[model samples]
Target: MTLRDFALMVVVCLIWASSNVVSKYVVSHLGVPPLFFAGVRFVLVALATAPWLMPAPKPLWRILAVGVLMGAGNFALLFIGLKTATPSSAAIVSQIGAPLTAVMSFLMLGETMNRRRIFGVSLTALGVILVMWDPRGFHASMGLLFVLAAAFLGSLGAVMMKQMDGVKPLQFQAWVGFSSAVPLLIASALFEPGAIEPAAAAGWRFAAAVGFSAIVVSVAAHTAYYGLIQRYEANLVSPLTLMTPLFTIGMGVLFMHDPFGPRMALGTIVALAGVLIVALRFNQLVSLVLAMRPRAQ
Candidate 1:
């Protein structure tokens, strides 16, 4: 990667990482309803990216569908989890999406999963199970289950995105911003009456959090991620995304003061290790590492 790519990746990682802290605050501090906040955030994102939607080509519909999974289902479930689960735990649980996606692709798309990927999926699933079982310092086991549901939806979206075409990354983000708003609004209306009034009452802090989510995190960070995919191989970009949860864990501890108990830590490590193993092709992984090693003078 060039310097610019490297810098962009760093920025994306930070923005995505901060999402956990911001989300925790929005749910815990501002008392915003999760589905309501997701709807509002995407509405802001749609407005922010409205110019791109006018042309609305046919290819965009599939993209929009994928966005609904990512933006609406993934986030709605995540927000539900956040209402009861801690930021750190949510981050760890949500990562199950990666391995889940791999397994789904193998089953649905007729893609083959080698031994390494299979092992990786098993480890990651076990890790998630461990984390779910512990619930040590965190509250709401049911909430964690909701977050896992969100991760599954996200994995489905990821798989769908692979089959999609003609949509740029930014365009994808914009459509998601647009499509995600509808379901979220519907859910909010049904489940979270008086949602907007409370958000308005909460004032700019709430607004700012929503704005950052829409503009900075959803729009900018995702744009960079798609951009990276354009520049590098999918395998390379995919593994690096692991950094996102790691960063989220850090932000949760430092910014949100989420407690990191032994169980959570161990679970995270085990889960991440599983994901890493699955993500990297064993022979290719060895070659890549050897290539990266410094040579003797």
Candidate 2:
């Protein structure tokens, strides 16, 4: 990749990472209901991208399943978890998705995993466990569990997505938006009484968060990342995106005032290393390094 491409990728990671900080503020400071906030964000995304909703992806049921798992199931858990969870812990724990996917694919699709992969998987789990032992409190542990559940759902959705066809990035977002929005809105209304009014009263914090998550993070940043993935090897793109979590942890400490210490750092390092192993082949790693180097004379 060229310098410009590298910069674009960095920007993408920042946009993605900053979302955690934004969401933490929205749920903790503004006191928005997690599910309701997620519902509203998707409502806007669905409206904005409604054009792609038509000519629905073939095997409509599969698309719907992906939407539910990737959209409603994952975000509902994540945002709820964020209500109590620090952004830093959320960042580290979410990395478990790579190993979770390996497990899911092995069980669901009969894919094979070698010993190295199994060790990486185990390492990922242990790292998450270590993070959960934080001295902060039990609520943080519960929040960690919620985010872990979200990670599981996301991994399962990724496996399902592999089975899908004819779903463009924007089109997939359209499906996720439409499929997730209604049920979430319904659930939020039923369970989170008075959620909407508070969002309206919260003023710019709520609106800014919604716009940033729905449009900038999901629509713009995700699409840009997908474009890079399409142009480059998956391994190359995957490792670079790890910057998102790293930055999220930093932003959590800097902006959200999330507590960070050796425990969090150790857990993050272990979890990310495992994710890196799961995501990249040795050859791809070398290629990625070469791609980053300046051309020789």
lDDT of 2 by residue, 189-254 (tens): 899999988899899889999999999988899889999989887877887888999999899999
lDDT winner: 2
Q: Stretches of candidate 2 above 4 Å error?
A: 135-139, 283-297
lDDT of 1 by residue, 202-247 (tens): 8999989999998899888888788888889887777777788888
lDDT of each: 0.84, 0.89
Off by over 4 Å in 1: 54-61, 135-139, 287-297
